[model samples]
Target: MSATTPPNAPQGLQNSIISFPDPGILLVLINRPKQLNSLTVEASYELDSVFQWFDNEPSLRVAIVGGVGKAFCVGADLKQWMSNNKKGIPMDLPTNGFGGISFRHGKKPIIAAVNGAAYGGGCEMAINCDMIVASASASFCLPEVKRGVTPFGGALPRLMRIAGRQRATEMALTGRPVTAHEFKEWGACNVVVERGQDVVDRAVELAKLVAANSPDAVIITREGLKMGYESLGVGDSSRLFLEGWSKRIYEGRNMQEGLDAFTEKRAPLWMDSKL
Candidate 1:
């Protein structure tokens, strides 16, 4: 429950809870409860660093990403985003994107323990994980379109591929939230439990099962799967699409209106035509 990182943790992990909750598993909790675990620029890089550390650590077989309070993560901190945007500062997101694992390609497995509402970039973060264990109270959504912003966090393409074009399109277009049960039915979540704490516990159990297997065999199997995905050009296509789409969206007037409306606690007044 402590938010402080262990002494052995990397310097960048101050904003997160990095703990060894299981014998061969790492637990990473996004610690900004007041902000609904929003991803600030610094937090995003630190999370990426933590995941990189996890990938290299021989003793850690798996990792779980969760949030500190009611939200798993609500995506980017709009306040920070607005401030940075106004200052003409660019959002230098890592190659991994958003929460550090959104676009990451690694041999090690990671599970998302969705304990509460995961929206926008948060939904993308969960989708990026190898598996998801969600609490019954948890919900997921991609509401960026309503705010006049596109979901360039790999969520759009990946969700289309994962949940089919129809479902993904509906969710993205409508900005409606889906329950954990619905996501489980859609195959996005592996398991759904009644309580938040149980979500992490279930993920830990699954991690233990993975950790018990042959490490080399697991890595090899994952690499083979990754190769197949690469051969199909999934990663590259998504990256290229995001690069093109995000540039226009981030620099457009609608994006500014969206951020301003969000900060003012009002609905965005989107332009009639696309930029």
Candidate 2:
């Protein structure tokens, strides 16, 4: 694998394209368009590895993450989850969570070039990026509630912090899709472009703008801001939520029902009667 490639990416991720479009900008495309770039365990790990590499490389100052199809990503691969469950294999969530960037703390800025729908963990991944440039057709949603799972990939806390508590609650609880324009207005997305392909161009333009600045200064500024945010207890709150609810949400009967319904092409019979 090249420096820009995932060190041990599985065959699925070996196909995840990576390219350097500028001197200090890395462009990463989630290549599984057929499945809406939904994340599998191996893909998550590979994504994490790629981000780690980008962070460590002094020459690579910024990264642009996008998907190669009509949808940016639709979240976890329910098919893969069902397969693992049928085989009695536990779901392997990467340390950095879905897409490897959700819970990751890195000084280097990553920009999401959302070309289409970003649902559930996909929405989480987009929000996790330092900035987002979304196409006009792009939409975002945390539909985990509909799937009988919580958005455990930092969506709960991060969305509330970025988009306000009321808006976040509406999104999480209603499981409704929010347009890119709406997200931009809500302060989640930074830019909204007219064309899908223009999303990448805008992201690259932003990356170039950042890359032209002093690298050390950018890193320090980012670190300082992150430190300030963490000092406000947001990080701790998110960690606590994750620890208390993640396992239950992911492993509960509700999740099973959700995946099964998804695979069976029917509506989920949610088992969480209390919720």
Candidate 3:
């Protein structure tokens, strides 16, 4: 539902998500247990909106995404795919692509708290996040090849960027499950927890650390770093970005509060006045 609604509010079919503000972190959980938390058309649109919401919310510097069922996500509904294929009609996809937030970039950081097997599009979902903290029981794979298709949701390309060309090739060609520990070793995930300990808790811990920083600074740094790495050619762009933020920060009250708090030896009370 509505972002203003509490997380414990009744869940609906179209809105199978529960989001609440936890200090500087926005806790988002998928509430679809049936179909293994499969992403529906409505859910996809809601996710796009959610990304925009998070982007505008200056108080929320970090986001933690997790699923409610035994698996994070099983990808698209095969029955729907078959039905549409039979009728010679293509499904209307969200603007960001296969899954709502898979191929898009946001201004803030999102940490995937993967608690179980993430396959096909699910794997892409996890990879889309800035970082991942997975449970020991968690596994990841892009097995679209086995189904006579390919993982088109940035899976192939993102995996290659994170895990290197050789590892990405092996995972894509084999369609085999990669354990969370192996993924950690491959630099695919940030941390791997034991099966019993709450992986979400681990993610929250990391989120809190990120939330401790200046929200604007965090957003600007992430944007600058991402652009610098992805740019075809880079030079004065970094300087331009810093200069732009330098001007914006001074215009906002938060920057002055940050300086005041530093001198006073206290934590700055931050609010998203822009929102």
**How accurate locally is residue 192 in candidate 3, as Cα lDDT from 0 to 100?**
94
Using all chains and alpha carbons, the TM-scores for the candidates as numbered come to 0.79, 0.79, 0.88
Give the whole-model CA lDDT for all candidates, comma-separated. 0.81, 0.80, 0.77
Between prediction 1 and prediction 2, the one with superior TM-score is: 1
Model 1 lDDT on a 0 to 1 scale: 0.81
lDDT of 1 by residue, 1-275 (tens): 12243345675456699778766678999999999999998889999999988787666667899999999999899998999999999888998999898888875889999999999889999998988999999999999888988888888877877788888888999999999999988778999988525788888888878765544445545654555454447676556545544565565565677678889998655442232
The number of clashing residue pairs in model 2 is 0
Better of 2 and 3 by TM-score: 3
Give per-residue CA lDDT, model 2, range 76-163, as digits (tens): 8899888998999987777888889888888688999999999988999998898999999999999887877788888888888888
Worst 10 residues of 2 by lDDT: 1-10
Backbone clash total for model 1 is: 0
